[model samples]
Target: MDTLKQQMEYAHNITLENCRVAKPIRFTETSSAYGGGAEGLSDGFAAGFLWLDKLGLAAKYQVTHLFRQSFFGGRYALVDMQLNPNPDLFLSVLYKRLVEGPVFQVTSIDIPAQLRLYAHCVRNAYYRTSWSTEVVRFGGDKQTLAIMHLFHYRVSY
Candidate 1:
C-alpha cells in the first residue's frame, strides 16, 4: 500500500510539472495484492480507491479485468467464469451511484494510517437539492468498514 501511494504521488507530481492546464490523472489498470480471496480483494480495492479519491490524485481508475477469462487470467476479474459478481463489483456499483466528481479537501489531525476520509458531491440524480457526501474508510486485517454520510442543502441562484 505504501509503495502504491508513492507511485501515485510521483505520477501526480509529473503531471503537474508537464501540463500547463490540469489534466485528469487516471489509473488504467490496478488490482489488489496477490493471494487473496474475493472478500480480501474487495477490501483492498475499496481502500485504494478511497485513498486515491481522498488525495485527489486520480480522476479515474480502471480495474484490471472484468471477466474471468483465460486470456487475462481470473485472478483479479470482477466476475467469475460463470458470470457471478464478485464482492468488489458491489463496491463499484455503489461508488458509481453515490459519488460524484470534484473531490473536496479533507483535513485531519492524529488519524490512524489505516483510516481514510473523503468528501465529494453527491450524485444529483439522487436528490433535487445540492448535497455533499462523505465517505469514511477503516481498514483492518482481512476486512474494511465503509460509511457514507450525506448532507443536503438548497442553493438559490
Candidate 2:
C-alpha cells in the first residue's frame, strides 16, 4: 500500500514538473496478482482506486480485463469468461454510483495505517441540494463502509 502511495506521489510530481498544461494521470492498465483469488483482487483494486481518487490524481483508470478465460489463471478480470461478475465489478459499480467529481481532502491525526477514508461529492440528479459521501476501508477485509450525508436547500422564489 505504501508503495502504491509512493508511486502515485511520484507520478503526480513528474506530471506537474514536465507538462506545460496540467493533465490528469490515467492508469491504462492495473492489476494485482495477489494469491487470495477474487477476494484479494477486489481488495487491491478498491485500495488503489480509492487512494487515487482521494488524492485526485487519476482522471481515469481501467482494470486489466473484463473477462478472463479459465485457462488464464489470473484473478485480474472483472468477470469470468462466462460473464459472471466478480467482487471487483460490484465495487466498481458502487464507486461509480457513490463518488462524483470535486474530491475533498481528508485529514486525520495518527490514524491507523489500516484505516482509510476518502470524501467526495455525492452524485445526485437534483441540482438544488448538496451531498457528501465518505468511502472507508478497513484493513484487507472484504467489506467496505460507505457513509453518505445529504443536505437539502430550499429555493425561495
Candidate 3:
C-alpha cells in the first residue's frame, strides 16, 4: 500500500512540475482496471472490493476527477451491456455516500495489510465545523480476518 501511494504521489508531482504552463494539470482515461475479459472484471464481490479500494486511493491522491470506464460496455464495465447494474455499481454508490467532507487523519494499531480503512467526517457548512466521524473499514482477502469499527462522536458546538 505504501508503495502504491508513493507511486501515485510521484506521478502526480511529475505532472504538476511538467505542466507548469497549463492552468491545471489533467489526467485522462483513468480506469479502475481492465483486461478482465468478457465476464466483466470478476464474478462477484471480488470486483467490488477492487473498485472500492481504487476509489479510496483516488480520493487520497486528490484526483480532480476519475472516469469509471465502460459504465455500460466492455469487459470491465460496471453495468452489463443490457443495462443491468452490477455489484461494482452498488459499491460505487456506497463510496459516493461516504465521502461527504474532506478526508481526515486516522491512527490505528496492528491493522492487517489485507484489511484497509478509510475515514471522513460530516461537516456543518453553515458554521464550518465538523460534527461527526465516518470511518469505513472494508477490505480483506480469504486469509484476512476482518473487524470493523464505526465511531460516532457527539460534539457540542
The sequence of per-residue lDDT tens digits that candidate 1 reaches over residues 1-157 is 5565577678767867898976666554454434433444534355445434423334322122222222233545556566776555555566667767666665645445764445566788878645444443454554433332343333211
Off by over 4 Å in 3: 1-4, 13-32, 36-43, 122-157
- Kindly list the per-residue Cα lDDT of model 2 for residues 64-98, writing each as its tens digit: 12222222335555565566765555665676666
Model 2 RMSD in Å is: 8.2
> Which of 2 and 3 is ahead in lDDT?
3
Could you give me the TM-score of model 1 versus the true structure?
A: 0.62
Best-fitting candidate, scored by lDDT: 3
Q: How does each model score on TM-score?
A: 0.62, 0.60, 0.63
RMSD of 1: 7.7
**Residue 93 in candidate 3, Cα distance off native in Å:** 2.3
Model 3 agreement with the true structure over 110-134: per-residue lDDT tens digits: 7656555556554344355443343
In angstroms, give how far residue 30 of model 3 lies from its true place: 4.1
Order of candidates by lDDT, top first?
A: 3, 1, 2
Candidate that scores best on TM-score: 3
List candidate 1 stretches off by more than 4 Å: 34-73, 128-157
Q: Count the backbone clashes (under 3 Å) in each candidate.
A: 0, 0, 0
How many residue pairs in model 2 have overlapping backbones? 0
